[model samples]
Target: MYVVKSPLPDADLKTVADALQGALVDLVDLALVAKQVHWNVVGPRFRSVHLQLDEVVDSARTHSDTVAERASALGVSPDGRAATVAAGSGISSAPAGWVKDSDAVGALADALGAVITRMRQRIASTAEPDPVSQDIFIAVTADLEKHHWMFQAENA
Candidate 1:
């Protein structure tokens, strides 16, 4: 396990680090779910939805890496265990079986939005705040909001 020591207050760093790890876990799970939808989605708008899902999943992966790196920078090992992430993630599990393309898109968007909200809260609460983590959250949130808008547009 690699840890990077920080000069910030121990309690603040520990709390922010834990939150960052938790957010990373959620991001990983959400990324996997988005990819699952991307691969399985089928319908008239398959091409469009498929491409959008791919983009969203890619963004999630990028943000997850950044968040995990931030945690390591703060002297904490980022959580990568599937079970740990599933347990900590606020995103709901996808149902067993193929879902309609629209529903899949909606589900993924909802999960990502929930994560974005949580990340925003955590970023604001960090005491000797990590700017890198905050920036990652900002970027991820914008991507998620775009995903949400796209999915909603598909429904309209």
Candidate 2:
């Protein structure tokens, strides 16, 4: 059942793999949530909110790829399937139906907050076992935090 071999001991690999998988699921779900809002967002600020949602989607997609690739490189199979994301993601489900501009902003900010919280935990968990993975978590956290700030500002 071992397709690839990881350099780290079983204990370290397990910790790193768990963090990577969690990050992958969250990022995938985050992208899906943002895209859902982008398509359904309505209201006076729709244009700007719509565009902002795309930025979040793009960043999530990019970070998910990086995390997945890192997992693969470390000999762990990354599962980004819809079922996996639905079952394992830390992000809450997006609201169904048309989302108002303000609602969309709030939703994304909240989703990003959830993901960032887990990302911080991952960052800490991976710090000693795998600084490489920790670095990725840090970068991803920075981007998600920036998006959260922008979305919160939209409500201001």
Model 2 lDDT tens row, 64-138: 999999999999999999999999999889999999999999999999999999999999999999999999999
The TM-score leader among the candidates is 2
RMSD of each: 1.9, 0.6
Q: Which stretches of candidate 1 lie over 4 Å from their true place?
A: none
Clashes of each: 0, 0
Give candidate 1's TM-score.
0.89
Taking all chains together, each candidate's TM-score versus the true structure is 0.89, 0.98
Candidate 1 lDDT: 0.78
